[model samples]
Target: MDRRRTLRQRLATQRLSAAPLPRAADVVRLLACVQSQERDHAFFSLGLRSRDTTYAAVRAAYDRGAFLRTHILRPTWHFVLPDDVRWILAATSPRVLRAMSYRHAQVGLDDPAHVTRSLDALGELLRGRAFLTRREIGAAFGERPGLPSAGEQLGHLLLLAELEGLVCSGPMKGVHHSYALLDEVVPPAPALGRDEALARLAHRFFAGHGPASLKDLARWASVTQADARAGVAATLAATPGALEEVEIDGITHWFDPSLPRRTTAGRAAHLLPVYDEAVLTYPAVNFPAAPGHPTGGAVDPFWEPVIVDETNAGLWRRTVGKDAVAVETRLATGLDHEQRALVLEAARRLADFLGRELDYREVTGGPAADDAKARRAAIG
Candidate 1:
């Protein structure tokens, strides 16, 4: 199989190499839910998918409830739409909670009665106001007697409220994210049945992050591998020919058949955000490396990827100063003249999205080994 062709096809399907969407909201709806832990990077993740958009514009849409950021799809922050939040959480939160079980226990937050009280309190508190930051909510929640509501414990309780559909992302209060009752944020959404929910989720995953394997689905959604298989099967059976399967070596992958099979002409580079859909949505990406090379060093979500012609040639970090945003590249492989130009242009794209001047730099290394190791261990 031609690895370049496969990679390009997947990138195009991810909307990275496709014609840009008109608006940031369109981008989020297309991707189902985008990984968005870093608020700035999350805004860029949406803005970069559009033809031309600014951080202010994207944040405006978010404040308008175009999408609601919350804990979903594998126990991390994701920008899920209000239309999608309830069903997606219902389908995925159990496994995420299981993954978070140790941390939940560490915070002494697993008690059913205690959780109910916290949620009830949070719901009532948020119902009184349109929005409140985490710290604001935490302080008030701490006032309630016999409830664990401080530090990591408060954070977990908020996460629980999110998972239980009691609250979602509220309007940005200054620079900090706030939370409000889900009911006030969006109209009531009836829950979907288990099988139907699974099928809808599977369809969204494969359609949005397609040319992906069952393992990718399971890993990304924190569902069981078997659950992933069942969802994929049901989605395929329910909507015949929506997805097409292809075999590269011995691995089977599925993608939306309607998306272009060929990438647009010319070499391209993208300053993909940290936890970018193109970079982190799939664990099965096998880039065209030299013989016997293991894999691209991309599992670290902390380092944003520098994609040069569909290969992960490096990781990048950004430093925002008053006048300009400096983007520094830590390269594992040297870039040719064309690739160097592309990477510089990609840096410019980030600056444009952030509405700042570009200050670019380069170096010769990947992410710190200890950082990647500890992160992988933490997630595992």
Candidate 2:
């Protein structure tokens, strides 16, 4: 199996290289979860994957509790649908809590009773109000000794409460995101059994982000290796013939059975948001880069927006002025007229989403050049 061919197939299957979903929540629900460490970018992440989805529309869905942002897999913030949030947390939070123990101790938050008390305090405080910003929540703990609401411990405390399903994100207040009690934010979603939850997760992972290996699933879901295998087994049992195991370059990988055949003759080049799952999920596979050497060192794959032509081409970023949004691209190599036009088309869509005029620019003599050089050298 050619690696680039496999990646292109995976991208098309994930809807990144095909027609977008119909709704913002649909995008989130399809992926099961989206890494949302960056807020405004996360909005664009959904918008870029949807049919006629606007920034305003995505924000509205978020405001309406159609999807929620909180710590899920790997103790990082992810955008998850309301119904899936409870089951995901139920299965994974214990592991996350255990992982966070050392950090909690480092910040004097290792005491379970004290942590419980803090969760109780935040729960009571949130019940009295519709929502509270991080600062407001911090103030609610107001000089309370031994409380983990000061310094960086504040975020940790909030994360703990989130794991326990006490609080979650509220609508943005201007530029600030606030928090609300999970119980009050939306009705309780039905829970799933542990085995069922793992199976469902395994299915979603492969369905939306597949052609992956057990290692990829474990890393992405933050589950144990044993659990990852079990989850895959359960998924196979639950939906026979849904997954197909294929050997790529002598290494076994699993993917959905129903991926579209290779077709990239006329599709426009795609400039995806930073940490887009299309690029993030398969971190182990280096596309448009050398095989067996995923991106790292010098080029931070998580930091820049990915440019996808046939495969991962390079990175792009945008700067906003009063009249227009200036899109600066640092490609690994040059593009043809058609490919450049397609990239521009993507940038135009982004400008439309932000209601800004477009000012496209090509950066020179910077990291893009260096990365291209490095890629060429690696391939040679």
Candidate 3:
């Protein structure tokens, strides 16, 4: 069979079976398409981490061991499935860590022995504790002499512990955050030897985000292209049925052959937070926007409430006050009446979701227009 036909059939099967699932559940299911493990990285996908509806689905996955917290992909915390985390982390983390090695040295944290000791001490403080706000945890370290300022030392320590799977955030505490020791919160993952881990990760990556080139996997996993290619070969050898190659604009891209063939009707309008995976996973060109409408692709990452049409549209931001939520849209071009109405409706939905009132505004052209970009530049 032609590979494209097989891919279409697989998608058809999924669409037929997707009939009864709720919107939030459906979104969560799609998340599994890109990530085999679910550790719900709170920072990147704020809505998945914070919204009640999405968070519930994510937590359920976590509780079931379908998702776990591991340092994977970008060397940042990612919510991956328990079965997949070990291999993904093993395959990817070293490269990411290596890139940061120089930064560690400049910051006086390059000593492996010192980093390990700091992790052990931090873990002991967090074990069995329900949750400690980052501040509280920092205080624990600050009390110790010869330690860098809590702000400085604790930041690096937490990153190390996260890489080691020693801890993760617990449920939200009224806008205050808490952390729990990983050993206490989740079961131990079986250890995998290096090559086995690398092969498994590569296979899952293609399975979830395949039709991707080896270079794409390498970029996404922050590993060398050689390692990524090794993973690609291993995955194809193990599961030939799962691979499919598609030619887009004369370029062959490998992706999961089984992804759904048709777009579901009534895909809900979402007010995705900054760094939502839907926007972050693919390049900016993948998002659908009004011709010339400023797309989130051009926006920096700190902005919130990215307004997505059926496909990723452009980015939006909202500020909530006691009376109403003020929405600001920065588009590449002016929106027509219908597009404006649609954007307002999205804002209203967001306000309702957050239990606030709605207000709308737009800004186009000039440096001040790019809210996210401006904020990031300011910080830099």
Candidate 4:
């Protein structure tokens, strides 16, 4: 597929241009897991994915453990389903544990003997408490002569606890997140072997974030390139018709064959969060033909994106004030009448998600921004 089709196909696949997913539960289940380091933006990510899920709704689901937010997949936080957590950790934890070994030592958690003892103590601390905030846990884990007592080292110790499956996220304790015993919160399911776990994760990634390449899978999951290829290959071998590949710019792209090749019915607009799976899952994302857009994947991969019909037309950010949320858009390209209106609608959608009044502005700065401003002025 060419760049235009590639971008459009991705939009459809990620449910950005197509009909949205039903609810927060469906969203996490379908996408496999969502990267959610930015807590508030992560809620919006779920809001954006669903048909009409509000921020309140997402939070409610989270409070009930409909999905879990924890440190997984490259050391950042992700919202993974409870049942999927065990298998995914079984597949990826060894790599993650190895990656964090230096931190483990730096934090005085170097002794596996002590770390194991710490987990035992922590498990005892959390056993029937239902949930405890990290700060609360830290206090209970008072100063020990040789043990990690407080701050980063202590935090790493807790991180190790999480990786070991001793605990997982509890509901938000008011605005602060808390932790619960994994066995208490998560419903039990049969375990999966490492190879089977990898294969399952591979299938989910392609189904939700596809027309993607093997390299993308490796980077996102923090698995070896060889493991990623093996996982994808296993999925291909098991269900040949479930997946298909195409050469986009000479690179092989794997995708679920069941998704239709279509874009949104009209000019759609979005304020996709930074690290939203739709944006971060792919190493390089193609865009529609527009001035200032790179012919190749041009998104810088850091900023929040302003999308119009599968194109990252510009960038955006939100500031939550007392009474209203301020949404500012920096356009890199011109928008026509309908496109401009669609962007406003998108901003309102965000405001509605936050249950706050809309305070929207389009700021102009650089040459591209100035050009876009001039074009919008002319159009008006």
Candidate 5:
């Protein structure tokens, strides 16, 4: 396939299939591919939306025997389906653990003996409890014998326990955080040998996010290029499809040819949380913003509500007092009358999604605040 044609095809696939599809269950299953708790709020962005939305998705996946709360990828809490988690962890966890070894040393957990002691203490404290927030768990540890500074120590201990598959964040309890034992929560899936595990994960990655090269896989998985190439080779050897090469700016990249194409419908308005995987996982070459965006080099990876037109023309936020939603557009040049109308329509769609009457102001001729009063009047 021609390089430009292939690149276009990949972008098309991502625009269509990258987001949650027909069923919420399928979305929850795909969440396994990218979720990571160690990176802080990224986990919440994965599937932990409102209490109702998150719980429904989790319960559905759990009932179907999908895995929950394991150190699958990026050495953090990812809710992999039971069938997929074992091989994913086997293929991906070693690299993440190795990367974290230096962090372990820095946190005064360099010795395996020390790590084991911490895990034992934690496991004992959490045995029968359904869940405890990190703070509550730390307080419990403070009362234990031979443990000091349990609050600070708890963080390191939890990291070790999570990496070892001993504990994970359980279902949300009305916004109060909680954690549970893995064995009690998710039964083990059948195990795969190392080679089989690696091959399986690579194939899943390509199937889920195909038309991607080894380097893209490496960056997403946080593994070395060598390991990524080996994984890709193993996957391609087993699969029937041919590997196609594409060149961008004179650099060659490999991708699967059968990847889906982008659909233009229903993609204009998105309330992407901060660090949504759609924006985070793919290569930068795929979704280049309009030239001269104020946020500069690539879009700021935050949960600002984005308005996508021919390009990412503006960003929006909600706050108290003034208009519930505020919009700021970094136009390459000022929007003509038609483009401005489209932008307002996009803003209205965003307001509908949030279930609030949207009050919006266009940042024309200057910063948005300069014309805030007029913009609100226009919306009214």
Candidate 6:
């Protein structure tokens, strides 16, 4: 397929420009997992993939235990379904454990017995109460000799416990999210062997976010290339004709055989939150005739919200005051009257989602915050 068609097709398959996924859990399930490091923006990420899911609705589902927020895939927070959480943690924790080995030693949790004891204490504390905030859980283990303070080591310990399937995030308490025992929060799903877990995850990635490469899978999952290849091979074996390879501009891309080619209706404008999967999943996203956009993928260190017309047009940032939400948009190229109106409309939708009045502004620069003088010149 051509460049524009490629972007649209992927976006449609990803539920970005088509009939959105019906439920919040469906979004997480289809994408295998979602990058949710920025909690609010991650809600917006789910919103982008759904038909009519509100921020409140998404939060409600989260509280209702439809999905879980945990350290998975890459050590950052991700929204994973409860059924998948245990296996994903089991499949991927070795890598995370190895990476965090030094921190484990530094925090005096390097000993397996000590780790098990800590988990037992945590489990007992949570069992005493349905959901305990991290602070509350940490307070139980107060400052002790050779043991890191709750502040110093609670997060690490919690991560360790989570990977061990002892704890997972529970309902939110005001602004704070609490933790529950994995057994308490998640419904039982049958266990899978290591190979089965890897295959299922690989299938989800390819089926939901495909036209993806093994390298992309490795990078996204933080697994070795050999593991990625083995998982892909297993996926192909389990479901013959499920994956198809297409050569796009002399590069091979694998995608689900079921997705049909289609154009994205309307202006194709969106205000994607920081770390939205639309930007994170693919290797190099192509934009049609976008001279300002590079096909080789751009590194966004700031994790700014993106304005997507056909591709990554520019970056955006928001300031949420009590009564109003102010959004600023910087376009890679100038927008026409119609395009600008659509962009503003998208921003207004974001304001509605936040339950605040819109204070939308369009300025220019790249992803970075340009100087005040430069901003003035661009606007003027």
TM-score of each: 0.90, 0.89, 0.76, 0.90, 0.75, 0.89
Candidate 3 accuracy as TM-score: 0.76
How many Å off is the CA of 241 in candidate 1?
A: 0.5
List runs of model 6 lying over 4 Å from the truth.
143-147, 286-305, 366-380
> In candidate 5, which residue pairs clash?
12-262, 67-81, 67-82, 274-303
lDDT of 5 at 193: 80
Kindly list the per-residue Cα lDDT of model 3 for residues 1-380, writing each as its tens digit.
34344333322333321232343334333343233222233421323323343444544544444445444567665555444544555666677777877877877787777787777777777777557767877777778764544665567667666665677656545555456786676567777876666666666555544344566566667778778767666667777766666654454556665664444434334455554454455451234554565543455454543443433345566676877878776654645566666666767756655556778887774235445666767889
Which ranges in model 4 have alpha carbons more than 4 Å from their true place? 143-147, 288-303, 366-380
The candidate with the higher lDDT, 1 or 3, is 1
Pairs clashing in candidate 6?
211-254
Candidate 1 clash pair list: none
Per-residue accuracy of model 6 over 79-152 as CA lDDT, tens digit each: 99987898888888889789989988897788887777777777877884479888876666775444334665
**Clash tally for model 4:** 0
Which 10 consecutive positions of candidate 5 have the poorest summed lDDT?
43-52
- Backbone clashes for every candidate come to 0, 0, 18, 0, 4, 1
Lowest-scoring 10 consecutive residues by lDDT in candidate 4? 293-302
Q: Which parts of model 3 are misplaced by more than 4 Å?
A: 1-71, 193-196, 206-211, 267-272, 294-297, 300-313, 332-336, 362-379
Candidates sorted by TM-score, descending order?
Answer: 1, 4, 2, 6, 3, 5
